[model samples]
Structure formats: structure tokens, C-alpha cells
Target: MGLSPSKRVDAALRRAPAFAAACDDAFDRCLADAQGAFRGVRLYQLADAAARLHASLRASVPLVRRWVPSPPPRARVDAALRAAGLEGEAELSRAQLGEFAAELFREAVLAGAAGIVGVGVAARAAPAVVGRVVAVYAAGAAAALYLSLG
Candidate 1:
């Protein structure tokens, strides 16, 4: 059976560190490509770019039971673009689309990258701390056993 929605989120969170580098690269490329097409592009090109951005993020997540699960990447990208002053228009200028892509990439990298690093740090630290605690407890139990025997 597939993982529950919550479990899928947890899996994404847990594995984000591994996928983060590629995600960053993809977003960076998207930003750069958008910037290059800074003038005289068709409307479909802009929409295509947005769609591609969504697909890239969707593909980045390791276990893909759904096209997109919770924390919807496409919605987040659109929201980020809107926040950056992209109105919901049927047609947009090349510069506008570039700006939208740039904003989306910037927000995604900023939020997701920071989170991945924080999670990575915590995940690594937790095991070491747990190992030390386990070791100390084992040592104490062994000493107690020795005392009882004596």
C-alpha cells in the first residue's frame, strides 16, 4: 500500500536533504533561462515555463505516488509569482513571465533550501545524541549488574 498523506509529507521532509541539490540546480537553471528570455516571448512560452517548473519539482520528490501531494509545488510557485506582483492574466509579457519565474525560483530555493539544511542538521545530530545516551545507559546498567554480583 502507498504511504498515507502525512507519511508522504514526512518522507519528503526526511529525504529533502538528498534531493535539495538537484532541486536548487533545476530552479537556478529555470531562473537563468527565464532571465535570458527577457523580451518578446509568446504567451504560451510563459505558461510552458510555469508548467515545466511544476513538473521539475514534482519529479524531484523521490516517491511519486501522486502527481503532487501536500505542499503543492505548482500552487506554491503560482502563489510566489502572484506575491511578486504577477496578476492572473490570460496573457503576459516576456518580462512579466521572466519576473514570475524568477520570483518562483527565488522563493522555492529560499524556503526549501533553508528547511533542508535545518532538517539535515537535526537528522544528523539526533543519531549521535541518541547513541551517546544509549551508551551511557548501557554502561550504568552494566555497573549496577557488577555491583549486585559482587
Candidate 2:
């Protein structure tokens, strides 16, 4: 039998925390690399770095949600996006923001999984297990970042 929508969402939330953690780790690595590659950069360069980071996080958010399936509270999602630097004068509805957050989570999960596999760690594990593990880690990272910032 197919899972109920709420049940599926609940399953996804369980994975969210891990995905969040993986995402944070990925961001930390990316920032470190960027800094190393561009030492003593100007203010504009720093701004550019910040922009890239924001874009990366935004893109990853949807992936993590898709892979891990965390149906966060609408208010939480909105607050997260805002904290992550998504800005607009217009009011965003809960549904819209929720969808965005879900998508972002999925994206992050996929990216995290890919990263793990790319580094040759996934070869030792079954594909399904690897995917699930990656989802959990990424979701956790994302949740930590969200809670800390939001």
C-alpha cells in the first residue's frame, strides 16, 4: 500500500536533520576553498563570494528536501529563507515557501550524496543504503544551520 502523505512527510522529516548537516559541511568546504583560491580579495570579491554561497545554499535546499522529504512548518521555511538571505518586499504565502524549502532540501540531499560518492566512499556501501545515509547526514546539517540561524 502507498504511504499516506503525512506519513511520507514524517519519514522525510526524519531524514531532514542529516541532510542539513551534510549541507553545512559542504558549505564550509566550499567557503574554505574559495578563500584559499582568492586570498586578499577586495570587498567586491567578498560580496561575490557571499552571493555564490547564497545561490549554492538556495539551490541545495530544494534537492535536500526532495531526497529526504522534510515537510517543515511553513513559518519555519519562510523564516529560514529569510535568514538565508532570500529577500523580497512582497509577502510569500506559506504553501509557496514550503514548496521552495522542500525543493531545497531535496537538492541538498542529492548534492551531498553525489559528493560522498564522488569521493569514493559510497563504493563500499549498497546504493540504497548510501543514498539514505547521505540524505540523513545532509538533512541533519541543514537543520542545524536552520536552527542556529533561524
lDDT of 1 by residue, 1-150 (tens): 855333334444335543454434444455466685633333334444555645655566433212233333656656855776755564455445545654554445334423433454567767666566556655654344333223
Q: Could you estimate the TM-score for every candidate? A: 0.35, 0.25
Instruction: Write model 2 residue lDDT over 1-150, tens digit each, in one string.
Output: 865333344346335554444434434444465575532322222233333433444454443333433333344444445553544423223333333344444344434434545444637777778778778766775565344333
Error of 1 at 21 (Å): 21
Which candidate leads the pack in TM-score?
1
Task: Give Cα-based local distance difference scores for all models.
Answer: 0.48, 0.43
* C-alpha positional error of residue 90 in candidate 1 after TM-score superposition, expressed in Å: 2.5
The TM-score of candidate 1 is 0.35
- At residue 1, candidate 2 shows an lDDT of 84
What's the C-alpha lDDT at position 146 in model 1? 32
Kindly report which residue pairs in candidate 1 clash with one another.
none
